[model samples]
Target: MDDQTLRRAVNATLMPGFQGPDLPAWLAAELAEGLGSVCLFSTNIVDGDQLRSLTDAIHATNPAALVATDEEGGDVTRLHHRAGSPYPSMAFLGHLDDEAVTEQVGWGIGNGLRAAGIDLNLAPVADVNSNPRNPVIGVRSFGADAGLVGRHVAAYTRGLQAAGAAACAKHFPGHGDTATDSHLALPTIGVDAATLAGRELAPFRAAVDAGTLAVMTSHILVPAIDPDLPATLSAPVLSLLRGQLGFAGAIVSDALDMAGASGGGRGIPEAAVMALAAGCDLLCIGTDNTAGQLAGIREHVLAAVRDGRLPEDRLLDAAARVGDLARAVAALPRNDRSPGSHVPDPRAESRPEGTPHLSPAGFWLGDPVHPLTAPVFLRLSSTANIAAGDTAWGVADHLAGELADRLPGSTCVDAADLTELAGVLDAAAGRPLVVQGRDLARVPFLVDATAMVLQRRPDALVVELGWPELPGAIGIATYGSGRGAATCLIRLLAEGSR
Candidate 1:
């Protein structure tokens, strides 16, 4: 098999889409050229009807061609129609602390996707968000606990498969530990192989053991495994994923266009060649650059195989796997409808925004609350008057600003101004004194100071900003940023019936 033959074979399994000044013509051209598959992004996907028609048209072009998307039921959903399914994300489910609820969310997501003519869900992110500073994948994951995330991934896979759709556990080795975005640049993992085996690889292993249909490789570098190449282009990582973890499913490469995988040094075709050489079965290129960019790879892949740069046997093997997956999906029982029929979620009832919703208030956060903004508001305004000791910094000033605006007549006292605060408390003896952003673990003296303040005013309202179970305050957990709306709600609480 020469480069041309391998190029032809490689062209046979692409899940490609197109973009240009004129997209419809681009779509037609890609189809006529015998491109293998289509992936739907936010732009390519419109409503359910439009998506169904688009998928139908693509299938009509090549009856055996595969169509795919990344509709993971949260912010990543493609068909976010008003009539579409409503499934909460991993963050919400993780907060619920019920495995049963997690499984049900998976089932709803899978059924909804299947109804929408999408056979693949590039979902169930197996990455554990170990680094709090990670810009992406924060609450998108289950939680910081790897074991909990693994269990949820296994459950999600089962629920999705039960509904006749395939689930792909993503960022194969792990992407949660990295602080940098792979879309911008390559992130290197310094943890030893043993540490990876313990923390990073746990969820992936669980996913593989649960018989997930596909595993999408990450672009991050794991020096302990393959120092030079990222996992998506590393035979060692893919082999470990398949051989050691016993993952017999299809291995899909993350988008070749991402800088972590392709952009900085290599061209798309060259990266595609390297990826295929590294043992990936399916190549997923976004619509933005698939047509002209990969045009070179189509021919180069064929040439590589012919000249022994790529193995002909590997090409055939990969193609067979892709075909088998398609056949498996096809052989499953079909759902014939008006091409856009789906059952609605029974529990989806409208609740007016700003209504007081029951939620768990605590010092520590394990999972994100549903209707996330509501609980956030409740916590932020739960207390009335604001007070602080001397030595308060910018964080204290920020809290003071929030209090002065949100809670009218709220007084902010510096530690140097503690005497003034005591006088004011004496004036309104039983009114609540709100203490914000106290890190007693770092400054232990603050513990005694806070106790002294509380002792004088037993009616004081103390909001612990940092950890769980603050010794002398009501704990409000703001798991991440962008919780300002929640702060407003808590401020409203402080003004009431005092």
Candidate 2:
């Protein structure tokens, strides 16, 4: 790839797009000419072998192309396999509040992607989800606190990079505060730059300072900073991001097909060209563009360059940055491999073996096969009835007061001091424990750790507060807090005694 070729490749790379199964004939043509990268959606992933074959095909045509996806765990996982990777959500990781757990998840996810031969992971969402009602960023962000989310974001970036995958922190200038969805229409955040710097930008700054390889711009409008152009097409926003924040990594635009960018009445390719000229080095076509739409985007770029409407240098620079990103990603070492590769685990806890029934709650200090194990919380809250020692008691005070009255001998646990539970579980000889919370799967090891203790005792009962989709030794889903869970548990316990 010489400079001229690389330049065209970069421009093509910036014109990122996705296509469905038919793989439009023009797709091959675009690849041959250097259209940068293609993002994979759920539709693109048929099976592991098929996915690997697709990547091989892409590389065969354009060796420098960067294949990317929204492999962010939870609501936004792209490469889900019934058998391959343990698909958990960001909410699960966020609930556990354990960096080590989050880091392992990143490694697992990153490793799984590398095994599939994908290069870029547009993940570790850096949005500071301050708006609880925020339709888009719910559970996608690490948490509400800027510093906390920042720490996890940095950890995710480091872990992904460590596992030989490039991590992209996204929705620059923060999309978390908006009330509307950017997919349908442009969302405007009237926040001033200082307030944004304090709340929204902190996590991104942390990611940038940690040497993240990519930072994606949002499609939302920030009147305080760049009212004329959304962050995706605003030089001022880019200046703030690059000049003030000193982010030298590749600057990516959120999907050009998104209503926020396209709403201003520009066609897809026009948006792509504008994004590049506005300082975005990569143009994401998002995932929903039709085949005809994708081809149109390509033709638009080609026409722009041919007619001198879009300077060839702009496209070249964007592609250069993309190529540089590809080099950086390709240079990293690979993760070992995913456990089940492609076959879904029939015995996976999410899919149990028997009739839906509850198990007796007993603690096993150690082991997986033991019958009497302590109860595990699928979504643990202090409001439940699980006995806790005096020192560990009252932890649930942070959860809710209504839940506090139901558990006679149970105690509450705060999110911050959960490590104490690990220590308590370690020292217990064998006791019936009931863990709470619907987010157990997020912390794969914690679930394993809790189950390891249960194996030492097999009489463990797992209590789930949300959906009863996951499996457990003895599974119970009371659905919600309060009397429903309390009444069900009391009846189950009374029946067990009989």
RMSD per candidate (Å) reads 10.5, 13.8
Each candidate's TM vs. the true structure? 0.69, 0.67
Query: Once superposed on the true structure, which residue ranges of model 2 sit more than 4 Å away at CA?
Result: 1-11, 15-24, 81-85, 288-295, 302-312, 335-498
Model 2 lDDT tens row, 1-498: 244563465446554545554345566666777767877776677777888988888878888888888777544555652221233345445544666556766777787788788888898889887775565675567767898888888877877777788999988989888878787788998888899889888999999987789998888889898778788888788777888779877887888877889886786778877787778887888765555676676668667777877777877777778878888887876555322222233323442111111222211111232232223222233321110001111113432332333334444332323465556555443545555543344334445645654665455455543222335443554432322123334434333432
**Model 1 Cα lDDT, one tens digit per residue, 176-282:** 88877777788987889898888888989988887688888888999999999988889998888878788877888888877888877786677777787888888
Q: lDDT per model, in order?
A: 0.60, 0.63
Candidate 1 lDDT at 212 equals 81
How many Å off is the CA of 41 in candidate 2?
Answer: 0.3
- Highest-scoring model, lDDT: 2
* Per-residue error (Å), model 1, residue 392: 36
